[model samples]
Target: MNITKDLVPSIAYQVRTQEGVLVDEAPVNQPLEYLHGHNNLVEGLEKALEGKAVGDVFEVRVKPEEGYGEYNDNMVQRVPKDVFMGVDELEVVCVLLRTRI
Candidate 1:
């Protein structure tokens, strides 16, 4: 399928980077879907993908400030482990992050 310009709202394959590390591959099906020119992606990545299309494989570098806001030390907080006393398994990254939902 040939995707023309402005044919966004189409999901584009996304790959993430940090300090030269390729952390994850954009999932094929659930890849980053969004309306083009609608600020659905980081400004830098969007700018890089400006003329791209589906089935297009490429890399774009996003600065921390544009991507995740440079990792604040304040985001790290110590909570009592007792918070998980009832849960048989407590996952650090995913489970602990469940609070957002």
Candidate 2:
């Protein structure tokens, strides 16, 4: 059966960076299953997989805009280390304190 909206799809995928660095992967024996057209998968990926059938192997390049709505440079900032006092492992604490712009 072809993949369509409202239908569940099991896909074996390998995600890589533009530079070819391996980011994530799903084995063929253990495909990632998700509901189609339900925002369960990335927008670009779901759109690319639409109408595809079983055993179909293809590649898709999802731009930042389609994948994560683009990166906002204004959302990033540098903070002082002193702000994280009492945290023994600073690297393990990946918290972003939001502030009103």
Candidate 3:
């Protein structure tokens, strides 16, 4: 079967820098799994995996916009300490993500 939207695909992957320095990879027996066509994987990887069948292996170059997007300091928002009231061990320069149920 080919990968498509809403379908969970398992993949063994390796990441490297432009000079081919090792960055990250799936564990020896643990592959990454995610629903295809969702915003789970990077835009470039998702596009490359589209229509691919099992055991397909290939390489792709994801630009900043497609991978992580160009970082913008303007996008950062600062919340007051009171917003995290009752939370213990809060640290400076940390990221907090709010998830929707």
Candidate 4:
């Protein structure tokens, strides 16, 4: 059956970087299942899966804009380390902590 709006799809996918490095994947034994065409998947991936049937295997290249939107240099800013006072064991690269200024 072809994937369409409101239809749930079970798929096994391997996400790779442009350099062909493995990034993430849904195990074959545990395919990812989600409601199609409901913003449950990335816009590019959803578009690629459209009209695809079960057992259909294909490669999809999702541009940054279509997946997570283009990275903006202006969005990044330098903050003083003192801002994180009283917090121990801070990692070099940590999860983003967003707040409105």
Per-model TM-score versus the true fold: 0.52, 0.70, 0.65, 0.70
Task: Give all candidates' CA lDDT scores.
Answer: 0.50, 0.69, 0.68, 0.69
lDDT of 3 by residue, 1-101 (tens): 98889999787777765556555677536878888897897787788788888767677777667777776889878888888989976653321111110
| lDDT leaderboard ranking | 4, 2, 3, 1
CA lDDT, candidate 4, residue 74: 89
Best by lDDT: 4
Candidate 2 TM-score, C-alpha based = 0.70
What candidate 3 gets wrong by more than 4 Å, as runs, is 71-101
Give candidates' CA RMSD values in order. 7.5, 9.2, 7.8, 8.6
For residues 30-58, what per-residue lDDT tens digits would candidate 2 score against the true structure?
77788899998667777888898887867
Q: By lDDT, is 3 or 4 better?
A: 4
| lDDT of candidate 1 over 45-91, digit per residue (tens) | 66666766455665555666655566677998987888877877754
